[model samples]
Target: MANYIHVPDEAPAVPKIDVTVDERDYRSGALKLIKELRPSWKPSEVKVKFFTDGITNKLLGCYVGAVMQDVVLVRIYGNKTELLVDRENEVKSFRVLHAHRCAPRLYCTFNNGLCYEFLQGTALEPEHIRSQPVFRLIARQLAKYHAIHAHNGWVPQSDLWLKMGKYFALIPKYLKDPEQNTRLSTEVPSPQCLREELVWLQQSLSVLGSPVVLCHNDLLCKNIIYNQGAGNVKFIDYEYAGYNYQAYDIGNHFNEFAGLNEVDYSHYPDRAFQLQWLSSYLEAYKEHKGQGSEVTDGEVEVLYVQVNRFALASHFFWGLWALIQAKFSTIDFDFLG
Candidate 1:
């Protein structure tokens, strides 16, 4: 039987005190929340911590001796848990309902907006991921996630084009201004080009007739962890997970393939890599649905264009946000640049 850490006799007590809305105090709150949440597990036992600390938010990872020693990831923020409880519950329900199709696990939301979960298996590094095989696996998994019958319960009412519009608005503010552009990038998109691309994306997304799915919009190599025994992959960090274009998930994974280091791409030419990846993914997706193709060749072509367009859109949206936070706060902007 796998070792399980029992809850301690007494939960660790965190002082009941609040501080001003500052980053230092936020860290303190996160530390305090961790103690309160895992009163049973010793802080020292947690290992292999990975997180990005900045103005956006904080995530902490540590190991607990559970089911072959699993990972406990905690995310902290200032918002009350009530605000997120519904979303978290929705996510949990989505996961549980799809347990046969994805990783099965337990999740808890602690005070101070800290959410933690015990996930099984080792996360895959960019170098270790077998591009063709894993790409196929991810595609099938996404199809399953999108197929769940959630009706109107959790789907975000806002349309995809509206979301793209918000992204379009930020490009100029980040790229045109001397200070902001210097802080973010040296080159700004020409006004004409930006306008044209925005129109193109709006039209493209409008005709995408596929139903929305629970998308892991951020499918960077780091988010996927390999499970050798199951011969499959699991995903984490569902913060960006929500109802969106099914094709968006495919595009995101394809983007990851394109962004690989020169060494990996050398092994597989870009076109060959995409073809193998898509073929495998589509095959698995077709098997799961046990029906005709859920996506078509024409749709895939549109997705390819959107992937590049979204890449540029994300560069500006996240870039400007980082630049503003860095200027307003003490955080570093190197990663943003």
Candidate 2:
């Protein structure tokens, strides 16, 4: 037998990318974007606070106390802005969950390849996440979100998913540990299994006959907020918002809950609590759509698989990205390790 083995490619060295903007430039660009968006607004009157060390993008706090009681949190990157306004566009798709949509949100791309979004409300910590009843509320909201929008044609047409797969393919080799990759890979069903499941899901989806609605793909705990006055949970960061599998939104939310550390999970106390939360969500969702008496156990099983696949895919995708960053000295081995 010819001795032939598949050897993974060596990690390629990445070149250094220059970062041109300093704190002053970031502040100036942010203020300018805000002023341009609202020409009548005075820069001196509004308080702009800077937030550094953001993992994804830079943030500049824009508080307008005179005009509105709420804050207009201006997210600033090198040359771009994400404006999150309050009490504007009513989220038309899901009626069960209360959400305020904003408009003319300035999204800008920076020279350093960063995107920014300006959102209102304070940053949420792990402790804050566990302290509130937002988990149940979010579950219900997502159920409603998924149920109302079935499949009317909108799906992610962006190249992001394809890029995501390319990134995932690099993780095992970049990590230099085939064993770890294998172990992580097994936690979710194989690609073959997913393809089969998707086939069935598509058939069922067509039979269900529902309109596809926009879904907020990134609904991590940080993206959700508790509005005390309105007594509802609001979702932020619509960057990843698009039409997707209804079950995907729910599964992603469940995964977000699962990703919480042990300290956070302790607050919920038992698997039953989680089940109850999921149940409440399903109930609300069914009520909003005016269909189905109960969420079947079979459906939950399918959702579980969907969630796992998404989680594994995410881990693999980010791992490769970290490797790319490491090659360029943008990230270090210690960070990847």
Score every model by TM-score: 0.65, 0.58
Error of 1 at 169 (Å): 4.8
Clash numbers, per candidate: 1, 7
Tens-digit lDDT string for candidate 2 (263-296) = 2433422345545655666677778778765787
Instruction: Give candidate 1 misplaced runs (Cα > 4 Å).
Output: 1-36, 42-56, 63-70, 77-106, 110-113, 130-132, 152-158, 168-186, 190-196, 208-211, 260-269, 292-336
Question: Where is model 2 more than 4 Å wrong at Cα?
Answer: 1-24, 64-70, 77-122, 127-132, 148-163, 169-214, 245-248, 258-270, 296-310, 324-337
RMSD values for the candidates in order, in angstroms, are 8.6, 12.4
Clashing residue pairs in candidate 2 (N, C-alpha, C atoms within 3 angstroms): 80-108, 81-106, 82-118, 140-281, 151-211, 151-212, 152-212
Poorest stretch of ten by lDDT in candidate 2? 84-93
Per-residue lDDT, model 1, residue 105, is: 42
